[model samples]
Target: MKEDIENTSDSLKETRNVFIGAKVTPTQKEHIKSLAGQCGMTVSDYILSRAYNFKPKARLTKEEAALLQNLDDCRSDLVKYISALHGMSTKQRMVMFN
Candidate 1:
């Protein structure tokens, strides 16, 4: 894990002297910019990633992220409750206990 992190940091800092260029219309430029923004990436990074045969994941909106967190919390709670229930005997789970 540490090695992976170091490699990623090194790659991020790698300098590029070469230039890649393409001509696109105004509408295409706007669309590409919008896509890059959704993925939380700069235009160059976005274009470079696509060139590398991979798509960058779009960033989640605040509400979407919050909902995912809430669902994860609920799933954790459910797991705990299920494990506790599984530890109980059928008699112990009776609803009409004296």
Candidate 2:
């Protein structure tokens, strides 16, 4: 019995040490619970996967997909603008700063 107790104490020490708490609305709690269930994971596991960028084959909703596309488009436009500026001669570039 003493050996079993010692083993249990050692096991507990090997487990995670961090704790986090958040105050979420009931709706938010339900949403997170549902998502965790869909992934066959506990809420902690689901949150950990997301927080660590684990890419668990999660699917984005249509709105999220659209927003991501818009962000990509904006990035592409910025790249093109920067490239255009980079290709200009120094005098031509300086003209715009005046």
Candidate 3:
């Protein structure tokens, strides 16, 4: 999806003069806008992504992304640490985790 975003922007950045208009009820417009907002996309982006068969994911805040990366690093470290505890029983491992 990230790659798709970059590619789409690169391909269309200087050539986005064509308009693709559609008629919808005011209620429908609001609903579409709400859906776009929920995914951190503009209405046009939400529509384009959907049209291109890409599943939209919620955009993350910078802080949230950093925290997730940190958590992943910690989990990797924990796996390495656990492997070094070769004498520990499986039961001990489970109990310790709990």
Better of 2 and 3 by TM-score: 3
Error of 1 at 33 (Å): 1.4
Ranking by TM-score: 1, 3, 2
TM-scores of all predicted structures: 0.68, 0.42, 0.48
Worst 10 residues of 2 by lDDT: 52-61
Tens-digit lDDT string for candidate 3 (42-69): 9998998888778888777789999999
List, residue by residue over 1-98, the lDDT tens digit for candidate 2.
75675588678886656799889999999999988876678899898777756756556767988999999999999999999999999999999888
lDDT agreement with native, every candidate: 0.88, 0.83, 0.87
Candidate 1 matches the true fold with a TM-score of: 0.68
Question: Against the true structure, whose lDDT is highest?
Answer: 1
Ranking, lDDT, top scorer first: 1, 3, 2
User: Which regions of candidate 3 deviate over 4 angstroms?
Assistant: 1-14, 59-98
| 12-92 per-residue lDDT for model 1 (tens digits) | 996767898899999999999999999999999899778656789999999999999999999999999889878988887
What is candidate 1's CA lDDT for residue 62? 97
Best-performing candidate as measured by TM-score: 1
